[model samples]
Target: MRFVPLSSRLLPGYGTLVLAITLVGIGVSITRPYLSLFGTDVVHMSAAELGLFMCVNGIGGILASTWLGRLSDLRVAKKYIMLVAAACSALGYGSFLVIHSYLPLLIVSTVLLGLGASAFPQLFAYARETASRVPDVDATFATSSLRSFFSLAWVIGPLLGSYLLQAYHFSGLFAATAFLFVAVLAIVFWRIERRPPAGILGSQPVKSFAVLQNRHVVTACVSYVAVYTASSMNGLYMPLFVTKALHGSDRMVGSVVALSAGLEIPIILGLGALSARLGKRPLLLFGSLCGALYYVGAWFAQRPWEMLALQLFCATFIAISVSIGMSYMQDFLPDAPGSATALYSNTNNLGQMLGSLLGGAIAQWAGYREVYLVCAVLAATSWLFLLRGKRFKAQEQKALRAALTSQDIETTQTRRAANGD
Candidate 1:
């Protein structure tokens, strides 16, 4: 297929989804960087408590996404799913303004925001399915561009977020996040058109809640978990590490993250274009290597600019891992975009959960800098899993070829017998 420029191939009504996704991106990026600060500064939670808070949040997201993800394939329209998620996000963040207690806040944040998280994967699945219907559109590039647009939102989101945090305080930050989510809900509800479930449209993909069990799929997911865990740890702690340990200001936190996310847009789009030619695994391995280097560099950085400069590698790592990771998982089960993207996205959830729990514990026990060291180790560990996945994929291909050859030979013998040869 000749891949065309995204400008010409917005997949008709897909511009609505893109707008919805970008809203979601801005909404999320606005508050995510400040979660740690909110915990320590506003709620006065200990590190361990923050870890538990994040873990619960992660679990909720996993459960909600898994259920909705499978349901989207079966009967529910993705538009509806996104609507509910966006609403939940708005409610969840809004709730933060009133509830300051630890336990109540944790429960509320976990369920509402966690369920809201499903909108993202569903959005991607919608894009993938939409792209599949249009012969001219390259589904891979389509999805990648969606991610880039989301990143583009981040370039503005964090800077705006920093201002909100400084001027309006955490309450204001959460309020703005909630408002953005409301915008997501409004756009999805009004502008986005609904399609019948993918199954109804005609696809007999693997059914039920069980994820794809192929060796390659499993290994790749495992690798994703490790790499993303490291990335999540960096996200969870980088704000505190800079402010507390390095004596950098709050604005520095936003600047560093926004800079990396800004750099990520172009890199993600380019790699998405090249992914078909270069293949997903090579780009993933390269990304994993970059993740390790960035963390190690971060671990040693004594100044703010050092951390800021490392974002080049950080941008590359995020671009390849996030953009390619979705397509890689989908290829393992091409017929089920919802399930595949869910599976891919859930690996991220698992990683975030572990990273949240682990980062907090490590920071409390050892120190902030040590978390980066741990992240570096996890990044390197991801490469081993990637290598294993490659071998398993090769073996699966070889076995498939052997099965086909044997089937052909048996058919030939049967034909000869029928002819009395």
Candidate 2:
């Protein structure tokens, strides 16, 4: 069969999923950057207290990714799960209007909205699995293309948040975010929930974590965790490096962030296509190496502008890892795209937890620059796991073939015995 382009294979309803993601991204970006500020400035909580509160959000993400992500794969409607997630997000964000204390902020941000944010990954899983039904579609590329919508959201969300902050303060920002999620829930519930695409029905219930049994999946999970952890560490400390280490202004930090976010959109969309051509492994390896090199270069930056320039490389690594990483995970666990992408996302949250703690400790003990060195080491370690996964692929394929052959033989013997009797 002739190869069908990923663009042509996308059905109409997939657009709804992408739009939902963009909305969610906007809602999240509006509040995410401000959450710490809100807690510290408005709620009268200390920075330390805010940090602990953020940790609860991370824990929520971890729990949701592991549990709810799999639930969508096990005899449940993914759209309904998505609906529940959105409602929770709305509830969490809206609560900010009434709840000003630290405890309420913690409960809303960490417990409710945090888990609700897991809908992001679930949406990806739904897209990947749904796209797989189309013959000749590059499901990974399609899904990654959808992923870029969030990057687009990142570009606009912060600016929108800033406007809300300047105009209406935290109350406006939270209300706008809550309303945005509610709007998405309404749109998706009407478009997809009322009329889901065909072939989205759940399969027989398998072991909820059965995908973990695959060695390739496990190794890929390790590599994903490492890559995300490094990225997370960079995210946490890069601003400090700009301000304290290199004496850059806040404007410079914002510019660097903007450049990276803007550049990542095209890079991610372009590389999603590239992965369809060169395959996911090479892309994954290349991305990981770039990440390692980018961090190592950060170790020697003498000026803020130099670090800003380095974001070019950082953008590349991020684009490849996020786009191809999902593709790679789905490749190993073809039968359960929801579970596969969920696990992939879980590693990211796990990485965030580890990276934040590790980076904070390193910064406290050594310095902000030392944190980059640690990130480089971790990125390199992840690359090693990627290599292991590559080498093991052949063995895994051979085992799969053997298992199929044995099952075939057993079926034949049973048929023959029945005929003879």
TM-scores of all candidate predictions against the true structure = 0.91, 0.84
Candidate 1 global TM-score: 0.91
Clashing pairs in 1: none
Tens digit of per-residue lDDT, candidate 2, span 1-421:
3566656767557778888989988988776655645765678764345445655667788888777766776656678878888999999998888988888667766777766866788788777766666676667668777878887787777677767887898899999999998988897688764323222452332332555666676788889889988887787667667777899864465566667767789988887667756778888888889999899999999998888788778888888888878777766556566666777788888887777667667776788899899999998998899888754364685575455445545766899999994
- lDDT: worst 10-residue window of model 1: 204-213
Whole-model lDDT values for every prediction: 0.85, 0.75
Candidate 1: Cα lDDT at 64? 89
Best-performing candidate as measured by lDDT: 1
Alpha-carbon deviation at 378 in model 1, angstroms: 0.7
State residue 141's C-alpha deviation in candidate 2, in Å. Answer: 1.9
Clashing pairs in 2: none
Displacement of residue 183 (Cα, Å) in model 1 is 0.9
Candidate 1 residue 171 C-alpha distance from true site, Å: 1.7
